[model samples]
Target: MKKQVVISMLGTQLDQGFGSARWEHWRPTVALGMHEDFLLDRLDLLVDERRYAKLARGVSEDLAQVSPDTQVRRHDTYLPDPWDFEGVYATLHDFLRGYEFLPDEEDYYVHITTGTHVAQICWFLLTESRIFPGRLLQTSPPRKKDESVAGSYAIIDLDLSRYDRIAQRFQQQQLEDRNLLKSGIATRNAAFNRMIEQIEVVATRSKAPMLLMGPTGAGKSQLARRIFELKKLKHQLPGRFVEVNCATLRGDGAMSTLFGHTRGAYTGATSDRAGLLRSAHHGLLFLDEIGELGLDEQAMLLRALEEKRFLPVGGDKEVDSDFQLIAGTNRDLHDAVGAGRFREDLLARLNLWTYRLPGLAERREDIEPNLEFELERWSREQHQRVTFNREARRAFLDFATSTQARWNGNFRDLGASVMRMATLATAGRIQVDQVDDEIGRLQRQWRDVEPPSVLDDLLGGDVAQLDRFDRVQLEEVVRVCMRSTSLSQAGRELFAVSRQQRATTNDADRLRKYLARFGLDWEAMKAARTTSGNS
Candidate 1:
């Protein structure tokens, strides 16, 4: 069995005893040796003042009379004020750091009963931190004069990993926090769920700038706001959250709005202004569409992030405002930096903690939950309940998750589709016919926004050589061909009115000639369509 060692402080007042009556009076250090069940091999006593050397020797001599085998050693740990928490902790920490410990040969215990309350707290901290490499031992005084003078002792182990219930509670709380960051949507997408988990950990632990990148309507703005609310709830931030869309800010107004301006700073300046940065002091500042900001604004923003000081537009004095930054952008900032539209240094600063949110189309598995969420929101705002018929609901979901649905505008499209169907539902019940009509409307909307990238894919760099008129005409023809089954069908749609005026019409031959002019054959166009569908 390993030897038992107790480290304790000498209680100058309580451990006092002299001569013949010392046994009658109950003293803590003397009672320690008188215990029958608890056998200590060695005792390390800490004496704070040099004046207590004689008293410490007397106590050692008294302990010898009760238990001669137990060895007592005195350490001079001089503390000017034992009541000072910082001073006592530093003193104890230094002593523990230098002390030799043999974990295999000895089991150590720290006696907290003899020290002052501050010293007790320090001992607890040191023991809990494993700096002392021991468990805490607390002893209480006897209640009655006839009771045994050894009193009662309890051992406290500070290692919390051994307790399962406490660990589970901490894990459960972390899950709840992650859910709050996601607005409690119960999303089914595995990748999106994992991303939210990391965001929660970073948002709570760090005050550094974060970059949120995604396409439009992909929930960057909403996520930024949720992060701000979570931090504020944790009491990590004290001021209010300030948000601004960089795309809406222009020219001199952008500078004035972000960094504030002094009275008579510009032509329209009437009074002093506290900018968004100042308003967000001790809080969070979310700059949406950050890539849209000018080069000058980017430079100023870098200064504000590195050193919490900046001068306002036309101001002579520098202002101080310390705030956490969260910047959101739909554009690729690396490309913008290369084009000289955005500063590279600003991108570097924001790139430390970057998270890219997926568009709605990529998270198709989460569409059902988000659909339910949007309907609930609509009901809460409009103050009226709406339900979908079984058939209508199935039809809408099938179409929403289908390959035909582009969802180019991401969650914005889903929200708007739900609102349109809800508004048109008769007596709060949406029918199958309404779902069909909504699907057609969505197809039309997507077609209207289809970019010229269709032609770019087919012709590569050759599309750039064509005039604006040719590019538009060819893009439409290519789209019709990809949707049609054959060249003849595509020609009939493209030349619908014009072909009727002709005496003879061979639609396939006409389309073949158009394809030949652009050096694109029918087989190549069909192959590209097949590849696009599989992707």
Candidate 2:
């Protein structure tokens, strides 16, 4: 005869101390087999003897109209408590000792019908303790009212041939979920799409360290997450993604934080701690602002990368961690190297899969879509729905185009601008006036100083040969004066004689007429005399 499978009905009240009473009230009824209409026929209801009588009475009283055999067995005989693993296993061992329920090295199954964490833990312990039947079955809680509460089950066949493959598949599914959650912000733009594709390829195809270069707010971290997600989705990695801002990793704290330290590693190192690298073992480690890392830390990082080995800050033993690296920075690594601030060898390692993200201004086409997305997000966050007026849209475009704003702050600035406008509008629509005003305010805030002009340039030149003329004519006169130093000297030198050649017809008026024709006057000449005594 085939060995009988033992199906255990384990029920416990969910913790209600945290104030989830609604989910707790139905628990006692469920435990008492009051919902027998919900269970399958083959399951055995196990309960403590003292509670069994009360549960049996309640079930018999309330569920008398249901089938007779559906009632749970109520015996006054004492059974060892199953709250602890040792006690539970002893009880089960005695109950199934010489029975056909025990499988002959195979065939029998142990099915657990409970969703509580304690039950899951107990089940795991039972398997580990070698008391569980050949196969383990688990059921998930019903998701809908019409769905059967008989529970969804899984058979952990754990056949040696397929165990590795099954475990890998399970881990892969978990990683995919994590990646999806973390990469929700990434979009399908050409740049981002290309970035994602490269990330996917790197995660699966290459083991090279990746460097994400971009200005602040250009989504370097987000891109890193996308890469992680793609890898996770492809099941190429089984490690958790750990992020660390090198800016925060400082001084003595750096060693302890990155590579971990043993208990009493330092004065205050009370207990052993696993550093971020170890925590990210078999995973991705994202280092943001990696350029901020000190030379010593850089050496440590280089060592880690080179050998996949590092000693904890205060610990003598070197631990091994094999993690894919993704670093991000707004600084120019090459410039840093040239300036003797970064190690060239370390940079060489990081250069293998580097990508520079385009700034907001460089990708103008993406601005509107990013704006719309941010506005919608802001509106949702503010608990309001807002629409952009046509003029508002035009005004935003105009403002964006009119200035050479670095948009170094990128999407963050845009999001903040939209949020501020939404707050100001309060109404359903964002007016063009508000956008214009906000842009004007930002321009004033970040406005560049105007450079000195050509006029200033000229004024700054030599003033030794300056001329007297109306401000309007000063420039031209100065040019002429620069060529010829004195006005009287220029007249005499250019016009042949100082006064004029003597006229044969010696009329003073005729001489004056001749002088006037040359843009000179007898009065101006007398003034030039300035009395012989002064000369």
Candidate 3:
């Protein structure tokens, strides 16, 4: 069985002889019935010098008579006043600094019954902070109605979340934290919402390197800024946020820009200069497109991250900067490591908390909300309000969600589209004609980027005889037909003007014969296109 050990403040007044047996009846009543009712292997008493000076010896002697086997050791602790918060805290805090607990051999507890309210509060703080490492035991005197036995006692833990109110406050704090990360943008995407909640938790607790991976314009930079803002609000960082896009930095100058340079370090280095890393001291450093950094730079960066110090370019002495790293990359770091382009160790360090944000295409459900967000931004920037007409809003949303619209540029495209329409809107209202004009412009821009003919493969050498005009037309015809659900829909679009004029329009027959002219059919052309895409 593990031995029981009790730590308490010396009950100076309770130890004096008051009545025939009244002294033995004192609460915490350590002098009487200790071995009988309150059994313990050892009793560690905290004795206040001035308060217990006269009665300290008598207190120890009286305890030995009743609890002979219990080893009582008294520590000389001094406090100006038992009720003074600072005095009691300093005395107890210093006592615990040198005190040792043998957890393997004994079960221990703190007896809080004898101390003043201030002392009790200090004890509770120490225990909750884990400096005490023991449960608190409170004792009381016997009640007048039931004086047959000793007083009652209860053990109270300081884990506040066990109570309903504290837990509710914690939940409210979490909701507020989520709003901070979202930047007040209301979104319904389940995956994105979950990611925001997780980021909130990680940002508040950790300062470790974090990696944000996603496609371009997928809000990685935006999220990094939000994190910096939140941390700053929480007083977690004292320095400014320093951001560098590695993809835009080139050659040897990139090194000096990131790690600073000393005088006479290089031909262009005329004077000593501090770099972005130093600027991020005691703050956050956001490295966007980190995979674009050179091998030499990557090696030095890894060293700085590991040691919290690094030698700058052309400098012999090392400089130190304690900064949190948040790296953003669109590339697959694992693939880069496998290809020997990225360091495995650096990847491992940054991979601690990786969050992959989905692109606009993946979160198409969010387009409507973001569309309104863009309009609101335009309103702020231009100092004028812009509202989409009912018909225009429906038309734009339909096109944005259609299969024909590939949001290749993700949020970038959406923002630009809203900006153009807002700019063209007459008298702060985006009409249907403005939406149509923007859609047409976007289609032409997208059409120019389409690849060269898949026709040469399917149509053989006959494809060579066709001019650029016929070639572009045939490619569009084939692509639209493959995507369409039925031949009639494809025919209606291909011959929109002429089919509308004819009294009895044979749309599918026209489309079939049009395919026959190229010596190809719908099913065969779709199969060949799929094969080409795979290759």
Candidate 4:
């Protein structure tokens, strides 16, 4: 079998004393001795090029008595500062890369007996990381009575997991990190918790474009902001958080506001303005409702997202903004792409690392905890802490999480509900009666705007006969009638659109006739409303 090869750096001052009989001191190398003494087949000594000749000569002369058959080779290694980690690591890494050794043919050992303190750490790091495929050999000085041999040595083969204490510490840290990302919200939601755990890992490790897709008021914006804050705390982000609601931006204003504009770009050209993109340089750019951006703006936005550069509205030169993006959209971008409203390429670019946030209705179990959070916020903002009576709290939660409760606006609606209860609290306490009143108010408000879910029951068998458009319009009409205390009020609201087209609009007559076509008149509508409220 081939002999074991030992790779080590030459000890600077020790080179003089190594096996030097004139000095009357034992050599660390001689103390280590040769192959048979330490089980080393060959020694690959990495030495300072300036002292190569003397070191090589000394080593060879010493090896004659230690182990004659053990071959010693000297390498002229350059390290200006043995204490500098980069200098030592780079030199060793480059040297190892040039060498090709078959592990099956020979065993390799890294002698940690000779380098500087920093060099020793680099060796451990490199070897442990498998950059240097070898076991570490650390040699200690000989005892007083033992003059026959050099020193005692220990072979260390690294298996990180075998270090139980370190492994346990890592596991504990991971759990803490996960909880931090979750904002310490101990939720019972399994899927949401898993998603939060994944998001924590991604936020901690990567700086990639993230897409937060969900319905309106589903906490996408909040989650994006939380991710930014987490990254900021970790020192991964050093810039500000720039947020823009794409829905509020339109026309030339949208272009100028997003990509900046040169002087004299538009009618309101007073001075050149650095747009939101420029403001988000080296920061996070949250484009909420990104789907609402115009197609022209979409093309420009896409270019900026991919190349980090875009031309101003009326400029010849391109401006650069190096920013990470967190895009939130409630719209179905795929459907928009199909309709030629959104670009497919832009969608593809933003689709990577997409996370879908579930709407509030989907995670009703979390509502109760969030209710407490909202109440706390209300106390901070309004300067009055409020608590609900046990019975009232239970009653409100039952109604809030029920199938009948259409949380159409998601968390926003819930927040509003909590706010109203907190504000109307007498002496900072919400009673059972207050809960009943709020539930009824919410029910009525939701029913008035709610999508027609019971079209079959309202129209009976006739629902199947009507086209989808007519069904939608009729549902709106019926829902309005159910909400209105008077037919004329419902008429006025429903036909407000058509009244603009004509000077005289008989909205009441038009609504009455439309209801007649569906075999439903004014009295039938009131009866249906009564039935709905009772049910």
Candidate 5:
């Protein structure tokens, strides 16, 4: 068992006793030793005045008489003003700092009943900060005059983990916050769910600008709005959420729209404009497609983000609008910077908390949940319930997760597919025919956007010498080679079906020979594509 120790201030008025009658009257320090349940092993008393030394000794003697096992020690602390919070705190801090603490062998308690309110507060702070390293011990006097002077005591432990209800409440709050960040979608992608959890914590704790990078229609804009809503729900931001597609802002109009403009600032300026930044004061500003911003606009945006103040277009004075920024981009800003199209300083500022959302095809496991969400949303909007038949649902899911279903537009494409099928459903039931039709439409859409042909550059118009069959086959083979990292990987994908039929197959050799028919090699094809890209 650890030794019990109590540190308390000497109450000059409350602890006074005279000769034989001292035992009859009640004293707080003496009563501390009177209780059998709180048998103190040691008592350290704090005294401020030389005049109180005699009373301190008397109290010590009384405590010794009540509890013979208790050892009394006196600490003389000088305090001219008992009510001076700073002085009292400094004195107590120095006293606790000088004392050697053995927490493993001893349990310490700081008594808050005897000192002035300031000293009591100081002791609480010291103990709570673990400088004194103890729990708080508060003592109350007897309620009735006829009651014993021992009164009652309570010990307060500051470690919150010891309390079940409070800890569970905090845990539940964090869960709700993460759910709110995800818009309660119940998404099934493990990596995506973990990323959302991290974002929830950061969104609540920080006001730094976040950069969301992904392909178009990958939910960057919707995620930004959800972040704004979460912060607003927590009362972190008071103003409205202002959003703008930076791709739509161009030339001088971009400046006027983002940083405000004065009347007669430019030829098209008709009246004073507050701009999106000013409107987002004390709130959140989401700039979607931020990579599309010009170099000059990027410079101005960097200044606004850094100083929270910027000069509007043709304005003399700078305006202030403190807002959190969340920037979204489908393009890589690093490439843009190398191309001299984006400002390095601005990209550095926005990259503090960057998140890359995966495209829908990358997280195909979440497709079913998102599909349900889209259907529910459509029902709410159209005021008509729509669901897929058993066979139709299975068919759509099979195709949706298949390698052939290219979700190039991410969630937007998935939502559109769901919408089309729901609209075409008869009597709120989507049949197999409806799903099949939607699948065909999606396949056609993706096929139409396939990479353009590179045969003209590769062949150099060989005087229009080849048949259509050879031309089509060679074009596809070159496209596959260009997309692949190596000859073997490209051959594996191209001969996926044909190679399976052969017991012994060298796909790389087969691919090399096939390319040689068009007078092409793997390295030359890759080089051609690289040259085309750089040019």
Candidate 6:
């Protein structure tokens, strides 16, 4: 007879507070193997709790009736903290050093049922580390009531050879979905059209050091990822896209974290670790908040860009890192350079392929599409289907068009507003009444007086006075000139000077000088005076 396949049944009763008893009655079940003929091995059900052990023992007795030789061992041990890939790898290394578990070539399968996301990531790491035997099997909880009680389960079979491909496809799908969701604000505005075009270009091009400049919340990072996807779809490149915020990489840590470090490179350098650049080799590296990178880091980055090589911290050997670099920043890099804060050479390299995303106010046409998109997202998040009523829609359009809400925070601000409205209108329909309070609140928060105009500044004497003319004369001249036609006409019509009669040489010269000062001629003065008089 074939050797009995060992199967483990792991179950956990989630604490549902007052509802725990009811939920516990419907325990989840798992089934394993290709034929699904394998029964739970009774010897594996080991428990320490007296009452629980008695209950488990009773269950084992029933299981034994079906499969007498199957071992049932249950230990009252706390489930391992959801496997952490990095932590597990470190632990496995230690275990190996201590010769705790000997490696074997035989096929072994470990079935996990309780932990969710953590379990998945841990399993992925284990497969990646090549520590697990055969492929890890993940079983889905049984569906039907009787089936669940009878131990029905969905199984996900992992093939090690296809792991990387599957992971890549999964990541791509997720990224595509995210982009579609975020860019849903359907805008056909010229500015938005240009942005889309630029994104497409970036996606198709394998050129490095792309720079994305825009105000905060303008979707810089989203655009970058979209470009990455486009490239992947077009087969322009093959590799994972990694994003790192320069703002988070501070001081020496930033350099080491980015360029990698050899063991004993620094005080805490315990292992020869691969940095993000090395990890992202043959992939895309997105540097967000590039402006926050310190001067030293900037110099190092510039050198790397120029030489295509960088020395890891405390390592003399230069490592070659050839990855497409995409950077984003809200600051004016030119200003940063002027202030001696940013490296001019680095900026020049990044400036080669630069894209500036316009803020929402500049692309008002996209607001409605974005709103609809947000509504969809909010509905999905709240687990409620909802729609905006005619009045609410009208109110939103009116507010969007009429109010000069700076929207300084751009798409992010709009998204937040949509989320708030969706939350308040979770009754399946959004109404004007439901959104009115929020509108009022936003109105108050967004209210801002426009900055005084240049004309106002001129009137307030903030402007420098011309040494040639007295203020009163200049004021009168400006007033009369604005109210009349050309200087000649204004002088003749308003000052009652006859154009036919030859005026004094001094007066004519003065008129010519005045015209020259304002970058006007006698003909322009005449036309202006005529137009002013008619008006």
| Predicted structure with the largest TM-score when compared to the true one | 1
Q: Give the TM-score of candidate 3.
A: 0.64
lDDT of 3: 0.84
Residue lDDT tens for model 1, 1-535: 9988999999888899877887777778777787787788899999954679888989999889898988998899999888899999999999888888999999999988887999999998898788889898877777898898777778888888887998899999898888888888989999999999999999999999999999999999999999999998889999888999999999999999999999999998999999999999999999999999998999999999999999998899999999999999999999898888889999999999999999998899989999999988998899999989999999999999986799999999999999999999999998999999999999999989977476778888998798777877888889899988998899999899999999999988999999888988788789889988997
Ranking by TM-score: 1, 5, 4, 3, 6, 2
Return the lDDT, model 4, position 56.
59
- Comparing 4 and 6 on TM-score, the stronger one: 4
Q: Which runs in model 1 stand beyond 4 Å of their true positions?
A: 9-39, 47-70, 76-100, 112-132, 139-153, 454-535
Q: For model 2, how big is the CA root-mean-square deviation?
A: 25.8
Which model is ahead, 2 or 4, in terms of lDDT? 4
Q: After superposition, how far is residue 165 of candidate 1 from its true place, in Å?
A: 1.1
Model 2, CA-based lDDT: 0.64
Q: Write the per-residue lDDT of candidate 2 for residues 1-535, one digit (tens) a residue.
A: 4423334543434311123343324333233232343332333445555655554454334333333444333323334554566655555556545344435532544555442344456655566555655566654555676664332445676454567877888778655544453244434357755655555545667767999999888878877777777777678779998999898877889888888889988899999999999998988999999999888888889999999999887778899999999999999999899888899989999999888887776666667767777877887787889888888888887777543454647877777788888888846888988887898777765544434322233444432233433333544433333344345444444444534664532344444454444354544444433432264
lDDT of 4 by residue, 74-148 (tens): 888878887788888898889989988779888888888787888889889889998888889887765775454
Scanning candidate 4 in windows of ten residues, the lowest lDDT window is 18-27
- lDDT per model vs. reference: 0.91, 0.64, 0.84, 0.83, 0.89, 0.64
Ranked candidates (lDDT, high to low) = 1, 5, 3, 4, 6, 2
Shift of residue 487 alpha carbon in model 3, Å: 36
| Candidate 6 displacement at residue 497 in angstroms | 34
- TM-score for predicted model 5 compared with the true structure: 0.75
For model 5, the superposed segments whose C-alpha errors exceed 4 Å read: 7-36, 43-98, 111-133, 138-152, 158-165, 453-535
State which candidate has the highest lDDT.
1
> Least lDDT summed over 10 consecutive residues: which range in candidate 6?
14-23
Q: What is the lDDT of residue 525 in candidate 5?
A: 85
- Candidate 4 segments whose C-alpha is farther than 4 A from its true place: 1-6, 10-42, 46-126, 130-158, 453-535
Segments in model 6 whose C-alpha atoms lie over 4 Å from true places: 1-185, 447-535
